[model samples]
Target: MQETNDADTTPTHVETAADLDARIDAADRLLVEFYTDGCGACAAMEPILGVVARETGVPVVTVNPRDDPALIDEYRIESVPTLLLFEDGDPVRRLADGFVGAERVIDFLA
Candidate 1:
């Protein structure tokens, strides 16, 4: 029997601390969103992030700090809807000013 993946074809792009390192390392430039459940601002950023991913051609991934508390300290995530841009496995920019428009995100990527 051929091996198969049951996961959806459309990428959810959610990452955990365990695999985050490898994921960022593989991408030339990757966007990571840190969020928590029950956050209104975080919820609002969903559509914006989707737009950023599509418009900028960057692989956007979400990581819930609650799943791995160390991520909070590691990334210095003081708030939800925080977006960090990693280039060559190193974080070079961060957007943690709460919900922002798609244009802002695209500019940040640039």
Candidate 2:
């Protein structure tokens, strides 16, 4: 995969929840964004997540809960644009307020 510092050039799309699990398990550290279609804040997080991935070298993946209804109840995702930080297949932190900037995201990863 090509790695880029610019958010516009990053490859951060995760197709399915199963793919998401494999990606997270494969990476030492990962940031997964749970989003919903037509969510303004969720849309806004795309580039920011890319920036986080580029700067921190932490692979970022995105999943729409609507794709899999079970994820909503499993993860307790009450809102759109919820961010989950994972370390070796285990979730470490969660950020689910709204549009979070790159700085806060970096700090959250730390």
Per-candidate clashes come to: 0, 0
The models' CA-based lDDT, in order, is 0.80, 0.82
TM-score of each: 0.86, 0.87
The residue ranges of model 2 lying beyond 4 angstroms of the native Cα positions read 1-11
Prediction 1 global C-alpha lDDT: 0.80
RMSD of each: 6.0, 3.4
Alpha-carbon RMSD, candidate 2? 3.4
TM-score of 1: 0.86
Q: Residue by residue across 1-47, what tens digits does model 2's lDDT show?
A: 34544532353776567878788778787788999889999999998
Which window of 10 residues has the lowest lDDT sum in candidate 1?
A: 1-10
